[model samples]
Target chain A: MIKFSKQQLKIPQMSKPVYLVTGGMSKFDRAIPEKRTEELVIDAFLEAAEFIKKSPEELKEYIHSCYYGHFADHFGDQLLGEAVIHDRLGLDPLGNVGIKTGGATGGSTIWEAYKAVASGYSDTALAMGWERMDEVPTDEGNHYIASAADKDWETPMGHIYTGYYAVMAQKYWQVFGKEEESFRRTLAEIAVKNKGYARMNPHAQSPMKITVEDVLNSPIVADPLRALDCCLMSVGASCVILADEKTAYELTDNPLLLYTSAGSHTLRVADRRDMDIPLLPNESPDQYKDLGVRFPGGDRYPGFTGFLAARMAAYYAYGMAGIVDPTEDLDLVELHDAFTISDIQSYEDIGIRPYGEGRTYVESGDCYHTNPFTGQPGKLPANLSGGLIGCMHAVGATGIMQVIEVAQHIWGRWSEMHADEAKWKRFNRVKPDDWTDLQVKGAKRGLAISHAGVGSHVTATVLVHPDHQLKGRG
Target chain B: MTTQNRGTVKVENGRYRVTGNFHYAYPNDPIRDESGKLLGITNPADMTHIHAYGGEAPFFENLSNAKLLGTKCANPKCETYGSIYIPYRIHCPDCLMRNEEVDLTELARKGASVHTFMITERTGAFNTLEKPIRFVNVEFEGVSTILMGYLSIGEPEIGMKVVPIFQTKNPTFTIMDLSWVPAGTSVEDLPEGFAF
Candidate 1:
């Protein structure tokens, strides 16, 4: 499987273009004991309907089929949870399916809905996702997450998913990072930035104005990765509605063009085989010839350092969207910052920066909303919704929430949605006195990367304004 | 208090023969808020699962005997012929043909080295390993992939040579029976119930 066939590398071409009409998210937190899962799901759907100026009953009329994403059914002690939600939402008699791809479940659910609209099976479709990780204790929740790994080979080792994932972070820390003190601080800076961004997001689970030293001083889950470096294990719901061009305008005046592509690797990192690096349009074969000379042990393609799945997903997505380079082509990104180190790795995987040089994205002040060095807007701000690190990692709802965050900027409604005092009061969260608008000015295109455990499955979702889409798309 | 007899299973004539209790049920408890308002109930149960490894059973069965087993794609017509896998593949991924089981005990003993390692002091429920589990992804000289296991003794560093040790005595018949240690360690210093 290392070598690709010509057919396998073909760029996906939809019969017709699909557009994201509107999307919404509920208040995300570590636990919501006062309400059942159905209530949170209804809250998300009601917001989406409200955004488009439609009633819940009116929105349900356009949904021909349903796709629900709910990871770890065992955690909720409910089998067929999707059906329960579908019935509660009053969408029955129409075709519906469930998706479970670990952390990427939310994106994969949208991927299915997008294809349904593209293939002419349905003019409009509903993609809803949610998770209830609070039903069980933290230790039991960790065991449920680890079950996503190979149960026999990996789960028996420690029954903790973080230990299985930390090996890659350790390798990246040593080889590319060179175990430098400054490099460790750069990793901590991501936590500080994401948590700071979370303070402005009322739905965010963890929000704190902290320094890099605070992150370094946090408890060590594993060597080189502190407690703050990890993402939150949250509970919440989020959803999006996809439609064709004709139906999109009917639903909303502004609809962003949407494209989704996915890729996967072996469940166990132990099974990864050495392969030649798949070059993106921005890279050349000669560009990485001396990677080993620059950083020893860095020549290995995806050798516990790079996520081949993310790279492959980006490969197809960029091709489909007619993107040659991400940083220059896209306005911003919402990367899956499951861990600070993994966030750096993804910057390289998606071609924001070349391999072994992801640290530059953060240090050069390009990843910030406002460049700390230049005192101007950052070239490409990342994770403005606080990402998994600060916002929430409610498994099934995470990816959908990331895409909705990006679309708000494209719709020129980021301020309208986020700056509402009613929303803060509704969620019962106190609005900060110094809340700043994080809307990327003149945003035309953006991307969100949804990833699963240890690079097992990854999906790339690219949303561009129909007026700004690139010509000669693959 | 009841003396619980855990469930056990055996395959006889292609059918499962079960003995003792396979599941136990507990009374559901009401979960209420401080105001004594009803919200939900807790459901508790314990159960056992029967899993068959199928084609890869040989790899686990030989671990208790202090043997490391791997698989090789011997298909001459395939694109990737003679590729060795430590996490033994049931069949060649490139070709659907069955793979030949090859003993990798000697190869692992002579040339295994640590590619990457991590130490974690936290574990989830049902974890049996000691706190601060030292995980090492070991690379063999002629293997196509790396194998993940724990270091039984000493700290781990990249490119450090290590040798395999098995819990030949009172084996658990799981992946836990196999471990790794610094290559030149003396036999007397091995962990309890383990041998090189």
Candidate 2:
């Protein structure tokens, strides 16, 4: 069995605190034929400046350094894309670096910027991420994405990334789900819920008022995973400004305290060796001793059914943010719903539910904006911005968008940002007539999980209003 | 247009001796909306990439010989000394030491079982596999990790026993050269160019 040294499991301690001053996102769509990528990026930046009641030039002055996240240069046919964006943003003279970690590119960018601000290297920093997946045809785009897998081993077999996830879904279905018909419908409910929530999101793509039956009947891309159960291939830009305490207060009176942590595992799932399940703060050591007995072939810690990277990321984040039980300590969360099964997998990985019981999180309606059972606010609402399923999976921009979505709720501005008719009209999208306001009232703290292909990379970003900051924050 | 003179490479004098054309260029096409509004241009091109397998070269080379090559960690001082890996890891993940290659053909033939599987009708660009591809993750006895491969014949079910098949005839020298089928699949039922 694999083991971790004490040094490897140490909670990350920052020399100084970092805060998120402001963030923004551009209109997301399957394709944006009207504007270039740079124009979309500029639009997102202008929105960030306007949110803080400052001019673009005024906000630009606070950025001491920049971190740009743009995955797959081949997709855009442009190398040094970050340099091009940096030049266009007029932050040329400052030190800047490019970050790419497949699907976790956006969160990795924020992690870098948070470190820069925390280390006193920069008083303020800009973490910007974007993706342009529309340049290539859908099949060719899938090829580009599958390139993220091991080039020699995994990529050659059908060159489809979904098939890789499909294998894991099959294992999870049999072992944890017991291949139950009710379990299959429970997975469908996540799609229905996320898409239904998307109707209220102006910047979302693929907003459908679909039912669980519609999801069950949609064309199956891979067995047990229908087309609607998958995430959208989108084009958009998102960005956040992180700063030290003095600079943050100088920029905005109310800035959320931010803590970002990252973890990684073997790039190829085939190489993941068996190990003991790393316990989260909320778990007991012997809580999973009978896992293999309970679910045959489930003894393997992460064997096709779990994302160890997400678990490690949450393990570190919970310690750093003093989050003992996510269900009780956090107000809301935005998880990477790359696929419906992977979404369920993440619920267990991030400690929302114990292993083999992720279906309960959705079935019990605890993940909804308003729990259907009690007609009250969900104990912990999840993916209210529709996540990657109903929203956009714009690769480099996705994690940043999730963090911004969570921050909006805590800022009590989710309705202001999502309900404005003028903003929806500017993007040429019709506001849904039943656009229910989904603002989680009195939200004080939240989290966002950014995950990469399979379980290679994951990052957890926790944000807390200063007044509601939990104790033991580093 | 099939190009008979695609690029090929060989090592000579400690350097790559490349031959023939490696890239093909095509004219760009305009992309427009229904109103004929200019949107973008499509740049079409084809190119070949020469990739070296390095230390993992033996695994691919052995596939056509009807042999399965895996690696075992040989460092006794390491935490996972005797752990064996398929998909051929060149180094022990725990100790960063070179792994000793081991033949797993007999073991896989006798003991490999399907851990999980999927059948996908969709594939990405440049895929050569047949439609409705059945993908399986096969786990062998005593092996710490499972290996992913396509099933050459029959539907896959969890816990179903399977045996390895290799593209011994006109092999592509890729991971595609290796496949799996039901344990009792006869030689006549094998796919073209493949054998047990």
Candidate 3:
């Protein structure tokens, strides 16, 4: 029993900061038929613990709580996932909860663990995300993924996840003048580039070197989105260890301050009226009366507001981290690139460029290893780990994998056995003698963005190197 | 080629049959029902729906009668914002207050406009026909919620006027029982009391 204070409490001047000391992820593959979800989680956890130079005993004693992120329990033929994982790992009697936010499960789990540490509820917490997608067949797996959408309307109407994105792509083409040839070319470039990057990442599931022509030749699953445009359904697990500033310092010399934020919209895509309407209501219809189109209605196409939730989340994260210009300030980014078009959308959503200019940004070759715009080496490389497109998309693990990639960039740990030398050379252009060149040189700040279920829920996290100078902070 | 005597083998009909203790890797087994039947749910009937909460009972009941119903938020502030929910939300999401049931039968007659639409070529449980299936997001008149249904007649165009086409024969008493067709298109076996 606890006694409650009736008096008003004063808020603290500064909240405790949370840091990610180390992170680990299993190799993303199509199907690890023999490995169970619990086994995969344990493997990732051990690797994360090893990264912090901690022994098994130390890890068992240090972690105060655990948060597991899993999607589609039926896919794995398991329930009470967190409890099973905890018991299997012999971390019982500790606080644990399972989080499900579709594809953003990993990011949401990290956010929950960050809160646990920031609020002084726990000093150290483990965030693990895993999914066993290979247990089911392709069509069944698709059905499981589509379950994230509105079952009452979207699912019953035969709106598969890919079909929904296809519709959005179609609408985008209709409204934004179908530069079909150029638009398709740009999309192909994205697929080719990401896949090309994946060829260097040993952990990536699809590391085959592909070209723009290869992408164009691929069969169209959904119109405008070819087979190469989508990510492979992968089975894998990832873990990130979050601790208070003190614990993080004790764990590792290099620590990354994690600032995470999330935003949600209607679950159903049709409910996203923002896609066709202005952000701010048009109260002054007379102001635009002279315009040919209806003043109040404004433009029927507002350029696909599906990524608005992600934008909102990123805005909150940037505000917290005091980052105004993300494209210039952040050294690198790891975004959810489940689909090639999704990567293009993330560029605008994460403020790399203004709305309706994602095509221009990609075409400029800014997202590549060497930017044509600035001519700077490794200028704002997005998805250095092959992303979900080149890398495999393990739904639950993808968000955590993004965070891990950013952490590796910040810590200068790109030469870790998994980094492919040839692929690295292709991306960076110059020959590298050591691990330093494989990383974003002098990178102090990075961002990781993730979303779930047709961009209905989004999470954006800004990570800063502990020693980096931050504005308005001593 | 010379035969290896080290490995155990038996010959039958000029073909060598390996009889050694060889390890064979088997793929993960599929889930089966209690009766040992492969429960591969390809059709929609293989799935089950359990409506534990009765909040949506009225909405489904109204659908069977060729009528549409919505819930109006009871809170004054919510009502001021013109908040009404289809599928009949029992409580207002914004105000966190109970909502009053509202009959939207007349609004259904007026029909809705296609807000957005998609033409899918792939076959699925709902899109069973070989031809393309046009799914539309229809926004009803004066209703905030957008309803999703298939376009039964004509092509799907943005802002195209469409009306609900309820199944008068053997209604499923589910949302599936209702679809949408181009406005003014004759619908056979409509409910006697309805004026659509």
Residue range B1-196, candidate 2, lDDT tens digits: 5566889899999889999989987779898999999998998879998888899999999999989999999999988899999989899888989999999999999999999999999999978899899999999999999899999899999999999999999998889999999989999999999999
Question: lDDT by residue for model 2 over A1-474, one digit each (tens)?
Answer: 268889889999999999999999999999998888898899889989988999999999999999999888988899999999998999989999999998999999999999999999999999999999998999999898889999888888888999988999999999999989999999899999999888899889878999899999999999899999999999999999999999999999989999999989888888787889999988999999999999998999899999999999999999999999999999999999999999999999999999989999998888999999999999899999999999899889999999999999999999999999999899889998788999999999999999999989999999999999888654
- How does residue A90 of candidate 1 score in lDDT? 90
Q: Please give, for residues A145-197, the per-residue lDDT of candidate 3 as tens digits.
A: 66677766566555366766666665554444253688888888888877877
Global lDDT of each model? Answer: 0.94, 0.93, 0.71
Q: Which one wins on DockQ? A: 1
lDDT for model 2: 0.93
Evaluated at residue B170, the lDDT of candidate 1 is 94
What ranking of all candidate models by TM-score puts the best one first?
Answer: 1, 2, 3
Residue range B32-98, candidate 1, lDDT tens digits: 9999999888888678888888988888889989999999999999899999998989898889789
Off by over 4 Å in 3: A1-14, A177-179, A273-304, A372-375, A420-438, B1-49, B100-111, B123-131, B184-196
Question: Which residue pairs in candidate 3 collide?
Answer: none
Better of 2 and 3 by TM-score: 2
Better of 1 and 2 by DockQ: 1
Stretches of model 1 off by over 4 angstroms after superposition = B1-3
Q: Per-residue alpha-carbon lDDT of model 3 for B1-196, expressed as tens digits?
A: 2233333455589666765333333334465567776643222113223333267777777676778788887777652345666756788766667788998767866867876677766534343323466777777776666666677668887678888866656666666667777888774534332224
- DockQ of each model against the real complex? 0.88, 0.78, 0.14
Chain B structural similarity (TM-score) per candidate: 0.97, 0.96, 0.66
